[model samples]
Target: MTGHHLAVGAVLRRGKDILLISDPPDWALPGGSVEPGEPLLTKVTQETGFTSVLPERLLWVARYPAAGVEYEMLGFEVTGVGPHDGSGSWVPLPEAVDRLGRMWFAPIRDPAVAYLTGRARVATLWTWTDLNEAPVTHPHVAPA
Candidate 1:
């Protein structure tokens, strides 16, 4: 809970397939640490190699403590770009969900996926004091 690591990730969709890094039985979104003052979308593009303009929306924010550090993940929804030289495969949503469920990081969960697929409302934001603890969800409200 002392150290803070902030990262950004994106779910790039094309037709019925979503872009994902091939991690054997698991998969990962295109993202990495937010370098000093680096834009999240830029980081995503650098990781995924998608250069065309796409609609990007902030979808979720997750906070969890792991390996004696606090980790914050920002997830986004975006339209897919043309093929790139990245190391990943485009898979259908169902397959993407299965792989994300098995990822080493805390599962991105179905609700988040649903949001990305435009099948559900934006998910409640979540925070956890420890990786092994249950997350606390907060509803979003606009300021008056």
Candidate 2:
């Protein structure tokens, strides 16, 4: 059986902008893996240093292969968050596509813009063969 890397991320929004974590030159959502008996939202807060409300529904699911391992990233629509301490900052929605250029992974960035801006209605799925290649988007994909 092939090993799989499963992770959950929150698309925290503030008005016309969204939250992004600066992980040493890389930008991404505030989230992490699902520990045994531990919730996804809890992991998000721990990793990103931001408090977030439970998402109303799943937003997206992305899959890609790298170094012989299959990676799966789940995205959720976090309704809100508590005060942040500058660890991570917010970026405008309209400018996110340009600002996130090469600074973050596409799987996370694309869905965040789509969902936050109301382009998608439900959980989507994405897959790609190469990290540099564009991902195939399937919006509102049903859960497996």
Candidate 3:
């Protein structure tokens, strides 16, 4: 669909800390929209300044609707993080979960937690509904 936007995010870790960028009152992953024909690793490196990264797996795929567009966000488990250029903070996993749970796209919180905690067996599919209050999750939503 023309109204759909594709984004890629990395679950970058340093021991027990996860990388998160400040999105004003909320925090988000260190990645951005993926351009056609561009490598996913390139986007992660550009946003996070991690020149050396190894993508472990795809963690989650979420369809989040905002303002009339649907964002198809793909989260990946990336390892081998080298030096960072001070772009984002390395927060503890628990703290990062708390911060992400309160973000605008709150639906991402649970899936991210599941993956980080070694509870996820496969990449999850999520549908997010914004009810003007807080976003809610509908897991394994069927594709249209």
Candidate 4:
């Protein structure tokens, strides 16, 4: 019951498969904390044994259906996995979600994924719609 937001993460893999931290009935990504001066994405990769540079962070979803706390989760596309990592499995998006609470794999159906599909922030990575906005500040990378 400490201040926390429902964060989620994904380790995007080949064949469009993903590494999921699953449960049952609801799947979630690998993420936590929204502290100011922290590089959220790097922390996920470092802690989870994934690559330091995630492919992308696709969403910033906010959920505050509680009291005295605010949670802002940033969802990302993790790239590679290291050997001896605890879990490295291919989980389809749908199955990852359906198995939520039953297991703790990477999440495949975090609602934030749907919410950020058309966001300009993510589009910058895929479509490169706004290169002018490059060097635009980042939590880890300063605008240069």
- RMSD in Å for all candidates: 5.0, 4.4, 4.5, 10.9
Specify the highest-TM-score model's number: 1
Question: Which residue window of length 10 is worst by lDDT in model 1?
Answer: 135-144
Task: Report the number of clashing residue pairs per model.
Answer: 0, 0, 0, 21
Each prediction's Cα lDDT score?
A: 0.67, 0.71, 0.73, 0.44
Model 1 lDDT at residue 47: 67
Off by over 4 Å in 1: 52-55, 80-83, 107-120, 140-144
Q: Which should have the higher lDDT, number 1 or number 2?
A: 2
Best by lDDT: 3
Q: Itemize residue pairs with steric clashes in candidate 3.
A: none
Give residue 101's error in model 4 in angstroms: 10
Question: Candidate 4 lDDT, tens digit per residue, 1-144?
Answer: 366554545445557455554334444455555456566565566445654555555643333323554444445665664642654455675564344434422122223343223212442211111323222222222211
TM-scores for all candidates? 0.76, 0.74, 0.76, 0.51
Q: What lDDT tens digits, residue by residue, belong to model 2 across residues 1-144?
A: 378878888877678777777666677777877765777678777755656566767888888887888888888877656765565678887565455544566666666656655666677778887989877777543221
Candidate 1 lDDT at 92 equals 90
Q: Candidate 4: where are CA atoms >4 Å away?
A: 1-8, 22-27, 81-88, 100-144
